[model samples]
Target: MKDVIFDDFQNTVSESLIRHKSILDIITKLQESNARINRAIVKSVTNCGCIEVNAKKQNTLENTNMDIESLKTCLSTQVKGTLCDNCRDVIQNEIGNNLFYLTSLCNALDLNLYDILLKEYDKINTLGKYSFR
Candidate 1:
């Protein structure tokens, strides 16, 4: 006789979730779990790169400094074509940052990014014509 703990797919899925509590579980446990997760990931990466943060204030300061550095590196460029360097950099960085933030938000909410974008686009398309002054 073989022992069958989870005989069906649904049971198996439940068992798996119980075995490995995921982001959903974390979110349920902590309202600000996503922020905590981001901070952990950021700090881990920074530590791995030999950056140390002894206090929360210091950690935030370092994180902000890094963000500024990233923006500086990404935003600094020479114009060579129709799009000016600063303009292109600003647009690109803003889009990239928003996409990154949205992606993280979706992950935290357990939402599919592609599907969300498709739905959002459909909604905008349904709005018909609109002029901005």
Candidate 2:
């Protein structure tokens, strides 16, 4: 039973990877965005702005950080690595929850997530190299 489920999961992931270029593109962009946001937040806090003025911006940055963290977890689950049955189920659940969270974040931020993804895809396509980092 465990083997059957693992096989099915692998197949599902494989098909998704082949059908949707956005998955990899999104993962890459999320990583880059997270790093950039973190740096901006650090700089904002270090500049010693008034609390009242920085509070709202800080809150939004924190929320965006959380969303990025969730997206990272979702991307990790998509990695092709050996896993047991329990780990596989956990990864699947994490992926589902993170994806939901990311979608909500996109709506909240009024962001066209696919647009970001497509842009990333174009960059990768032009480079002809997968190693962006």
Candidate 3:
């Protein structure tokens, strides 16, 4: 009887420890995911010069030939020029899509973590009401 009780206690403790570890693992993954998303957001925002007044002004001239020549010169000088409207639109669309996907992923992970925590809480509460013996 004593051995059986000891085994039962050990199994209970083991299960609890496993749940705790799982929660910790999930939390760590969430933190890492959050950090990566934040870094990507910052990088995207920094790299996006499409909306700047200077870029708009540079590209506003009506002479396409002159613009092409200027772009050629700029390219020769290794200076980056404003993106053409089509390219700009494509990039903006891609950024929007990526942001949406990342937001959804984060939300899903958050909900999963919450559910795990709630389950763990309920298990602990139920365990608290029981006598080990």
Number of colliding residue pairs in each model? 0, 0, 0
| TM-score result, candidate 1 | 0.33
Give the alpha-carbon lDDT of every model. 0.44, 0.46, 0.47
RMSD in order of candidates: 16.4, 17.7, 22.5
Top lDDT prediction, candidate number: 3
Cα lDDT of model 3 by residue, 14-130, tens digit: 344332245555455446656665554344346655332223234424655554446544433222456557555655665554443333333434433334445777887887635
**How close is every model to the real structure, measured as TM-score?**
0.33, 0.37, 0.26
Greater lDDT among 2 and 3 belongs to: 3
lDDT of 3: 0.47
What is the lDDT for 115 in model 1?
64
Q: Kindly report which residue stretches of model 2 are placed more than 4 angstroms away from their true locations once superposed.
A: 1-81
Report the backbone clash tally of model 2: 0
Give the distance in Å from residue 92's predicted Cα in candidate 2 to where it truly belongs: 1.7
**How big is the RMSD of model 2?**
17.7
How far does residue 3 in candidate 3 sit from its true spot (Å)? 57
Q: Name model 1 segments beyond 4 Å from true.
A: 1-83, 130-133
For model 1, residues 1-133, the per-residue Cα lDDT tens digits are 1123212322333343442256654444344444555554344435442333333222333455555445445442232224345444544655544444444445556566656656767777876333111
Name the better of 1 and 3 by TM-score. Answer: 1
